[model samples]
Target: MNIWVTSWVAADDGVRLWTATTGAPGASWPVVLVHGGPGLWDYLGPVAQLLDGNRVVHRFDQRGCGRSDPSDDQRVARAVADLECLRRHFGHERWAVIGHSFGATLALAYAWTHPERVASLVPLGSTGLGDWRTPARAEHARRASAQQRARLAELSGRERRSAEEEREFRTLAWFTDHADRERAWAWAAQDAAAPHAINWTANRRLAREVDSWPEETVRARCRRITAPATVVHGAGDPRPAATAAALAAALPHGRFVPIPDAGHHPWREQPSVLRALLLRAIRRA
Candidate 1:
């Protein structure tokens, strides 16, 4: 069975970040899971458990998110620096980095800035480089039913939402993130109810920074990264896997993997496949 231990790590700016470590008691290979949502708290707990206690897994709430102390600094650079601080606090010279969605983008940025400090990078369901949201939005609309779409629009048009209304809105908003239409609502609802409310302020700030990255400069940086990166995305995700494939191609040592019949969160739909791929990647790294 996997054992979990929680602790606190201070970022360079002195924000107290909540962190946890788990897995086989003496597991060797160290891996850190970075959750998506520039503003969301750590939601990779399931992924860590899916690792099957084979390696030490680390997870943390980013600054101003979840259990971490709130801070005014929401810069992308600061987030990367906070990750480095977490690594140093754990005494890992190099470690495997696994990130999902926006977290994937952040992981890429981290690897680009600190190539030598990263052993391997696994980006799961990332938005990828360039403009991916347009296609993604269209896909999401197509996947959502008319009633779901109407309800979502109604909730979004609200000037202010009560707690229940907000949850409903979020659930509907995320309903298209799964390929399994029957299960998508449940999965999205679970996500909406997860601890640590979405930090919209931090999301806006960090998203702006992410959007500012010039494509050419980003590709040039990718070419210089030493660690291997595996860009894995769901075949049914709203975000086009082709964009992720292009991202992989731009990297010096990057490969792309597309999971069948899965959407944004592949683990929820294809746990075994994801687990096998992750185990192999971590062991090889």
Candidate 2:
């Protein structure tokens, strides 16, 4: 693994976000790696490794997660603001953003609000423009085993869960097969263990906000993004590929790339292919 420097940056609301950077600071194109899960810990060191030689890569634990201080403010808007603060902290004129799942949504929100600050947008395994939970729930039901289904049913009405329980639920819900789940676990195990790194309170709060996000508003903002964009989706991902295609189509300068036989976490399932796609996006930017 390559060495990198870690630091803290204060957001507009005085929240200190934990951040790290790798690769050459003077690189022509800087890329920010945004991890999925609004409340998940930052475990994207491997991602940075993939592109470290060619571009500067930045990763951070968003507010209320990982090394950052816990807070009641978990709004998506606040996340966008934090991203902007990160950009300024780096003193970069503009940078490309690569995000997965919910982080992809945050990347878009940032670009939509400040298009000029974004050099490129790469959204992988992204949630669609509208309510994605309905189809996601249906897909989970169809793919889950009887025991898994029962477990999910039992947890459905519950309002609280331990970090361990939430991690288990996410493992079951995010991956389609045992191999994929194991791979995700192994990837995450490399990161420093911190109690309450995945904040359930913030996760639940932000999830509700995402569920009610307006489709028209998202579409309108997407259409305004003129930065070069690449929307990548995995073939085996529960979220329909059409959602990614639609999002790509919506952007003035966007294209879609579907990875075969892969799930939501393409880097875990097919690192070479994911690396190639990421390199391509960086070049385009």
Candidate 3:
């Protein structure tokens, strides 16, 4: 079932969130999914299979992301507050959270402040929690993607891509399943058709505004969290395993699960493994 999650933020600005509920309204177990990009959609189509027992699984797009209205009001702490409001409004005393990429970033922020609210966290395709040199890596990726766009006709229209779009497309394209050369070409073609301008803007802003977060901010909160924590990462992800390792080390009850062949978007590339890992996390959650 799809539930409409609405809330107000810093200003009197109201935001409407799209939420997908797996089965019942109040299940014994609940997983609140936080999507990546702060400007990206939940992309919950593939991961829907994990809600087998018809438990309550929720996915929501942050303000200015997905179907939500657009806004440049950027702040990490504010996003955390928004999440807390949503959790309380949804009536979940404590929830297991699964954050993907930027969502994982929010997970760190939320978990840090409200450990009692989140029972556990399953961060997938985490962007930067530990030691991610995101600026340098993203800058390099931007240049590489620009080069790719120039050489390949499939990337014709992407030559004028924003720096963030270049980085997102180039990196995310590498994780897609093309099946063959033809499919790869087609995929590239599709990517060039519509560049992600919004995410690019948000990413650039976020990179500039927030570079790194200290564990102390979130660590003290983690210690209080009795819920088991597991991190699911794509083995093929370009972000690097060291980042995840560092993040896991910071947390007292953190376990890392690396899925083979999956890139940045583990759930998209390795659905079976993603499902299994999520199910396992659910059991543990």
Candidate 4:
């Protein structure tokens, strides 16, 4: 079994971000995994473990989230700069960049900013460029039952929630993110129990920055990035996979891969297929 080494990497602004890595330097090209959420911590440990044993894998919590130091400066540009700091600290000339959910957009933005430093790009279940949230919310609502919706509404309407109530709220909120509805409750409940709490401030700040970018602008940037990009999405995701296909079409060397009978987090339901796609991207990189 591969052993992971955990430590802190200081950013340009003296903020410390927690990072974990597996495998030795020079063994193979390194890959950095960026987890979803502008506010959530590094929860991509399973994704890292799924990679080839001979490859080095890196995971980190972004500044102001999880184990990282709290900071008022939470801009999209700042987040991109922090990622560059991590790369320079590790002394890598270029590395494969993989991201999930919102992290995927951030990874694409990073590549746009520093194309020369990205050997390859993988945006898994990315919140695609353009207005996808409305349809996504509609699909999520369609998937949720009346009782579940009521419970979610009640919890969200509250001024404060007990720990148990918070967990329940999260479970309900995330229940639609899996293809297997029967097991989604259990999986969402497990996810709700994650150790790190969401950083609402960081989430709001960075989300605003991301929203300001025009679709045409991002498309223009994508066209400039020459790195091979594979945009992966689950067929059952509330966020339409067509948006992901559009992102792929924007990139010069991008390809869109849809995972059948999967949702937002494909690896949770289709680990083997996701792993195969990831390995293919890494090998090509």
Report how far off residue 170 is in candidate 1 (Å). 0.9
How accurate locally is residue 21 in candidate 2, as Cα lDDT from 0 to 100?
90
TM-scores of the candidates in the order shown: 0.96, 0.88, 0.75, 0.96
Query: Would you list the C-alpha lDDT of every candidate in the order shown?
Result: 0.88, 0.79, 0.64, 0.89
By lDDT, the better pick of 3 and 4 is: 4
Clashes of each: 0, 0, 0, 0
True lDDT of residue 127, candidate 1: 84
* Worst ten in a row by lDDT for model 2: 185-194
Ranking by lDDT: 4, 1, 2, 3
Q: What is the lDDT of residue 12 in candidate 3?
A: 38
Report the number of the highest-lDDT candidate.
4
Q: Given candidate 3, what's the lDDT at residue 61?
A: 63
Better of 3 and 4 by TM-score: 4
Point out the higher-scoring one by TM-score: 2 or 4: 4
Q: What is the lDDT of residue 167 in candidate 2?
A: 61
Give the Å error, residue 18, model 3: 3.3
Model 4, 235-265: lDDT tens per residue?
Answer: 9999988888989888999999999989988
Name the regions of candidate 4 deviating beyond 4 angstroms.
25-27
Who wins the TM-score comparison? 4
